[model samples]
Target: MTDFDIPSFLKTLSQRAGVYRMFDADNHLLYVGKARNLKNRVSSYFRARGLNAKTVALVSAIHHIEVTITGSEVEALLLEQTLIKEHRPPFNILLKDDKSYPWLHLSDHEFPLLAYRRGRRGGTGGKFFGPYPNSGAVREALNQLQRLFLLRSCEDSYFQHRSRPCLQYEIRRCSAPCVGLVSREAYQRDIQHTEMFLNGQSQQLITVLQDEMLDASSRLEFERAGELRDRIETLRLVQEKQRVYGTDRNMDIWALVEFQGVTCIHRLVFRDGRLLNSKNYYPDNLAGEEDPLLLLGYISQFYLAGHAAEGLPAEIIADIDSDEMTIVLDALRQQFDRSILHSRGVRGEPRQWRAMAEENARVGAQTRISGHQESLRKLERVSQLLGLDKAPRRIECFDISHAGGEATYASCVVYSEQGIASQRYRRFRIRDVAAGDDYAALEQAVERHLIRMQEASDLPDLLLIDGGQGQVGRIQQVLERLSITTVHLWGISKGETRKTGWEFLWAAGARQPIIPDAHDDGFRLLQLVRDEAHRFAISGHRKERSRSRGQSDLENLKGIGPKRRRALLLHFGSLKNMRGAPREEFAKVPGVSQKLADQIFAQLHGEDRSV
Candidate 1:
C-alpha cells in the first residue's frame, strides 16, 4: 500500500464521528486523529493541494489506515488520545512529559495529618497535597501549615515508640500528641484548623489566631500571646508570597510551540482560584508541521493519557478549538461524570494568558532542542575516544569481589547508546575457586559469563574488566578456551592516586598500554562504563560480604548439614541472634530437634553451661 492507497481507505470512512489511525509500512502508527465527520476530515489528507509537504511525506509511506467508530464525538476523542499515548504515534502531538505529579496525602487514621507524597501509594492515614510543580513548594506549604496549626508530622513508628515529648514539642512545631502531652480533644482542634488551612480557609485561621492572641495578652499570658503572634505572622508571610494570576479558581492553560521540527507544550495549572505552577514538555520531533489543529490533538492526548489528570481542573483553556477539543472534553466528562468547560478566548486577558502559555511552550521547545544537540555531540565524542570499530552500541563490564577468599562474587553491567540497560545487567557467584584468589575469581566469572553468552547467542560489542593486567589475562584465557575470537575485551586499571583520569587500559594481545584519547569522546564513554562496572562490582561485593558475615556462625555448628544450617539462618534472621538464643528458643525453631537444639546451645554456651 502507498500514499494513493491511503486516500482510497479514507474514502471508505463514514461521515459519522470516530477515530482514525495512519500506519507506516513497518506497522508502526504514524498518526491518530478524531473527527466529527470521519469521511470529510480523512478525505482532506489525500487531496494533493490540501496536504503539506510533511503530511505528503507521511502519507507516501502510509501502508495502513484503521478506524474505530464511537458512539459520540467525545468517545472518539478519548479513544484517539488513549491510542496516541499507547502507540506514541510519530505524527501525533505527544504529551512528551510523563513524570508523576506530587500529591499531598493525609493519613486515613483517626489522627489524620497532611503530608507531601510522590506517586500513588503510601501509608494509610493522611491527606495528600498538590502534585506541586516541585518539592520545594510542597515543603513550604507543609511548613506553613505545621507552624500555623502545630500539627504532628512524625511517622507512626516514631509516634508509637516515643517515650518523651521529643524535639518537636520543645520547638513548638508539634503538640506532642504521641506522649499524651496534649489531650486528644485539643489535638483534634489543631487538626481541624490544619484541614481548614489546606482547604483554602487561611483567613479563618488568621482570624482565630488574632482572637486567641488578644485573649492571651489580656489574660497576662505573654508567652502564649507571642507564640500566637508568631504563628499569625508566618501565615501572613505565606500569603504574601502566593501571587494570584487569575480569579479562575480551577483551570489549566495549555500552550503549544513548534521550532526546528520539535514541539514543546506547557501547562499552567491554577488550583483553588490561584496560579499554582506550570509544567513543560518537549515532543520527540514533529518534522516541521506547525498548526493549531496539531496543538489541539496534543492537548487531548496529554490530559487523557493520565499524566496530569488527578488534579484535573474544572476547565481547560487552549489557543484553538478543533473538532478534537469536543472529543477530549467529552471523554473527560465521561471519565469523571462531571461537566468540563472547553473554550477559546477571542478577546480580553484570557487570550493574553493563552498567548503567554504558547510563548512558554516555544521557549521550552528551543531549550529542548539545544539540550538534545548537546547530548548528541557528547555521545559522538564518547564513541570516538574508546577507539571503537564504530562507537560501541552495547558495552558490558565485569567486576569481581571476595572477602578474604570467602563468598566470591562478580557482577556484569551493560550500557547502550540510550543509557544503562538495567535488564541486561547480571550478577554471578563465583564457584570452583580458592578463597582470596582474585585471578581465579576473575577467570571463573569470565568463563561462566561466556558460557551463558554462547548458549544465548548474546555477545556484547565490547567487554570491560574491573582490574589491571591480571584481570585482563584471566578474561583473555577464558575467551581463548571458549574459542570466542570475535569479542573485544579490555581491562581498566586505576591511577596511582586512585582517581579518575589515571585509568590504564589493557586489551588482549596488546603489548603497549592502549590508553584512550584524553580529550576524545570515546575516552569519556569508556570512563563512564568503567565507573559503572566498578560501582556494580563494589555493591555486589558488599552485599555478598554482608551475607557471608551473617552465615559465619553456621560454620561453628559441626553436626549441622547445609540444609539445616540454611533453615537456622532463615528462621533466626541473622547468625548473631542464632548464637545468642537460649536452648528453649533454639528447640522451638523449625527442623531443629531437641538433640540438635541441645547441641547448639552447648556449643554456643560451652559444654559446662546448663540449659
Candidate 2:
C-alpha cells in the first residue's frame, strides 16, 4: 500500500481527458470520476474552496490514486462509469434496485424457446429483447406473444422428457414441438414473427402473416391458414393497444421529487410508442446533495454495466438537467455505441409522460411521509398509556417457539415507531435450556442479547415478552443481576381462552395487570409487536427443525462425516436427490473411497450391516 501525497499526485497527473480512481487507506475504492482535463479535475478536491462536506470527507480518506488516460472525453466518461459500477464506492449516489430487470429471451434451439427471463449468464447465444422496467410488463408481453405465436415456454429438460403434448399445447399456448406436432420450419416462422413483434415491427408482421395466410389458403392448407389468420388478428390488437403512446418512439422518462431530505424517483419506460412499464425508487444516504447532481449520479450508475443487463435506448427524458449532462450523454453514447437524445423538456407526449412521472414521485413521497406520521402517532399513544418520560421510540419484543421439544428457538423483534426496525432484530438458537421450556429459553435469550449489546444506549426503552408472570419474572431477575434500572419490561399474557384481543399486559415491579381496551391504539400496537415476535420466532424454529431433521439422517451414517456428507449433497443438489441416486453414483463423490461408497450405498438403500 503506497502512501498518497495529494499535492505531489496532482502535480504528476496528466492534463488530458481520463478517468481517476481514489482509494482509502485499506485500498478500498472511495470514488471514481472522469474529466476532460485530468489534472484540473483531480486538483479540484484539494482546491480548498467550495468543497462540500462529503467531498472533503472523501479527500481526507484517500490514501492512493489511479488514473487511466483515454483518447477522448467520451472514452473517459465511459471508463469512469465502468469503474464506478465495478467498485460501487461509498461516496457515489447509486441507483436503487437497478438489477433484476426482465428481458425476453429467444433461445437458439431446434425450436426456438421464448420466455420471460430475469437474469442470464452472459452470452447464452440468445436474442434478448429487453430490460423492461418491471416483471409484470414482461409477463404481459410474454402472455400476448404466447397467444399469438404458440411458442414453447417449457424448459429444455422438460421438453426433452415429454412423452406427449402438455397442458400448454392443449390450451393452444404452445405448438408442442417436443411431440413433433408442429414442424421445424413452421415453428421457425412463428419465432421470426415474434421477433418482429417484440422489435416494434407489428405492422410489418401483420402484413407478412396475411400474405402467408393467403398462400396457405390457396394451397388448401386450411389449418395452417387459420393459424396465420389468428396471428394477424393478435398482432393488430397489440398495435391498437399501443395507440396511447401515440408515436413509435422508444425511450425512458425519469422524474425526481425531494421532500425534507428524502427523495423519490419514478421511471417510465416506453417501448414501440407504448408505456410498457413504470418503477419507483427512494435511494438513501444522499448527504444533502442538490437534486440535479443526484440525478446525474443516478443516471451514470444506472446505465453502467454493473446495473444495466440490457442496453439503453437512443433517447432519455429527464426532469432535471445538470452541467454534467454532456459528460453523462457521452458515457451512455459510447457504451451503447449510438447517439443518445436526452430530452429535458418537450411540448406533447413526452411532456405528458414526464408529468405523470413527476406526479408519481410526489405521491410516493407523500405516502412515505404518511407512514412515518402514523408510526409517530402510535408511539405517542403508547407513551401516554405506559407513563413513559417520552414516546417509546425504541421498543423491543421477544418470543420463544418450538414444536414439542425439538429445535427450540428465540426471536427478538425491534420497533422504533417508524414501523419494524429490521436491522436491529435478533434471533437466538436456544442452548443450555431444555427443549419446550419457554421460561428458561426466554431467560437465556435475554441474557445473551444484553451481553452482546455493549452500548448502554442500544438497550431498548421497552422490553416486551410473550407470556404471563413466569416469563416476565425470569427476565426481571436477569435485568436485576445485570443491575439495569432505567429500562422497562412488560409481559403479554393471553386470557384464559388464549385468543387474540383477549390479552393482559404485565409491567415490571407492578403487581396488578394493566389491561387496555382492545380498540385502544396503543394496545393494538402492542398486539402487533407481540404477533411479529411470535412470527419471527416460529420462522426460525421451523428452519432449524427442518435442517436438524436432514442433518440427523446424514450424520447417523457410519462412513459419512461432515465433509463427505457436504460433498455428496452438493453433487446431488439435495438429500432427496442423493437418496434417489444409484449405488454407482456414491463412488463419484470426491471424498468417498470405493469401500466407503459401498457402505454408504448399503446404508442409504436399507441394506444396512456392519461398515
**Which structure among the candidates has the greatest lDDT?**
2
User: lDDT per residue, candidate 1, 1-611, as tens digits?
Assistant: 45433422442345555667777778777888888777788778767686788888877877866554433354454456545555677777644353354556777765666677875674454565443434665677678777666788887777789888888779888887777888878878887776666555666666667678779989999999877766655454333211222354588888777543457778866666544444566655344445677677677677677777446788888867556588888888888676778767445445545654664565455344334233355456645555556655567888776657767778888765445555577888888778888888778777888899988998777788888877788788888899997688887887678776677878776776666655454565566667656656655666676576774546646588887875565444456555434334455455787667768865653332210
Residues 197-247, model 2: lDDT tens digits: 777666555556666776898999999887776555444323322222345
Which ranges of candidate 1 are over 4 A from the true structure?
1-393, 402-406, 545-611
Candidate 2, clashing residue pairs?
Answer: none
Worst 10 residues of 1 by lDDT: 237-246
lDDT of 1: 0.64
TM-score of each: 0.36, 0.38
Per-residue lDDT value at 144 in model 1: 71
Candidate 1: residue 482 lDDT (0-100): 92
lDDT of 2: 0.71
- Candidates' lDDT values, in order? 0.64, 0.71
Q: How does candidate 1 fare on TM-score?
A: 0.36
